[model samples]
Target: MNAYRAKPLRYPWPPVLYAAAMLAAVSLGRLAPISVAQSQGLIPWLAGGALIVVAVSLDIWAMKTLIERQTAVLPHRCSSHLVTCGPFRYTRNPTYLGYTIMMVGFGLIMLNPWFFILASASVALTTAFAIRNEELHLLSRFGFEFERYCRATSRWI
Candidate 1:
């Protein structure tokens, strides 16, 4: 059976789910982190800001591609087309990767080692929660074309 067909919980959406995971990470990180990237420094702020910018840029690019293709962006909906241009050319999931990158920036701003740990967990959860089903749907709808695209592109990078 395909992954999407075998799926159970599909609520909370990927973005919301990701945010909740990040928050959980921050809460745990506040308890006793091994080390902080920066207790007090301008570099931390600048680096966090830079990472956020990078994340936003990738997200925008991916969304633009979706709009151009007239494809549905939401996971629950079927896409009208398999977008292979722009950020999709590099990663099958630029939007999710962008969110993960933003979470990393958040961890940097918080200067918490635990947040990084949580971010890693979040990535795995995201892969299972969102990416797998999304891939399954794409595969079912587009068949071999989507498989070829998957072969050509990274899941995240």
Candidate 2:
């Protein structure tokens, strides 16, 4: 019998980390504001709005796919099945991608340089703390099927 179980992540949830990062960025920006542009223009508004929409749509699609497949949505839980349809076809980590995109969108909308800087840091932390363990667990559980999916799909898009 397989003895391995997907262990809960030692770190906080990715969303929490993202939120903290955003907060920190905002605080830092207020203390030392670095202007990206002279004015809050229409271009930033349109671009940011479009990005937010895409991020939300991707997240919903990914979550729905996971639910339909009867797999765990939270990273801490073990996946019951390998999901390869919907947004999963494009990115192995669609949810994380969504989070990152959302952060970027907010950064643009807020015109905060610190948001862009900390967004990169947030991705790095998430990858190190979350994705590494998830990949290992999925490999241990799903074996070659997960490997094939990894080969076919990008981690982020």
Candidate 3:
């Protein structure tokens, strides 16, 4: 008899992509600064701050849920089971969504157009490298349960 063992992910692409995008945005902004508006006021700061708070809240909720479920939070590690509670009930990729939202909030706060652009790129890269791979692993491991969850929940909100 052959026993099937799930293989772990090769790289933690979500955080890495987000970090790289942020670095690129900062570097590009420093080289040639692009402001959202010439006369930036309190509006941007308020909106950015609100978004940051929401993103942080969502991330914390998701992480807490993962911990409570006793599942692996790291991208490279294999999750023990399908998580469909708390934030997972809404979005399949809450952590990645939170990262994207935080990047957008930072873009607004810094008044840097590059951050916005790089944030989109980060999503694309993360989807291609991280999310897709994670989905495959989950489907292989959890099969029907994962499929049911995917059908019910959106990838990102």
Candidates' C-alpha lDDT: 0.79, 0.85, 0.85
Q: How far is candidate 2 from the true structure (C-alpha RMSD, Å)?
A: 1.9
Give the per-residue lDDT of model 2 (tens digit) for 1-157: 4333555365448989988998998899899998665555688878888999998999999999999999988887878888999999999999999988988898888888888899899899988888888888788888999999999988887
Q: If scored against the real structure, what TM-score would every candidate get?
A: 0.87, 0.92, 0.92
* Candidate 1 residue pairs in backbone clash: none
Better of 1 and 3 by lDDT: 3
For each of the candidates, the C-alpha root-mean-square deviation to the true structure, in angstroms, is: 2.7, 1.9, 2.2
Off by over 4 Å in 3: 1-5
Candidate 3, residues 1-157, lDDT tens digits: the string is: 1122264467776788898899999999999887555545788878888999999999999999999999989888878978999999999989999999999999888888998999998888888877887888888888898899999999987
Lowest summed lDDT window (length 10), candidate 1: 3-12
lDDT of 3 at 18: 91
Model 3 steric clash pairs: none
Model 3: residue 3 alpha-carbon error in angstroms: 13
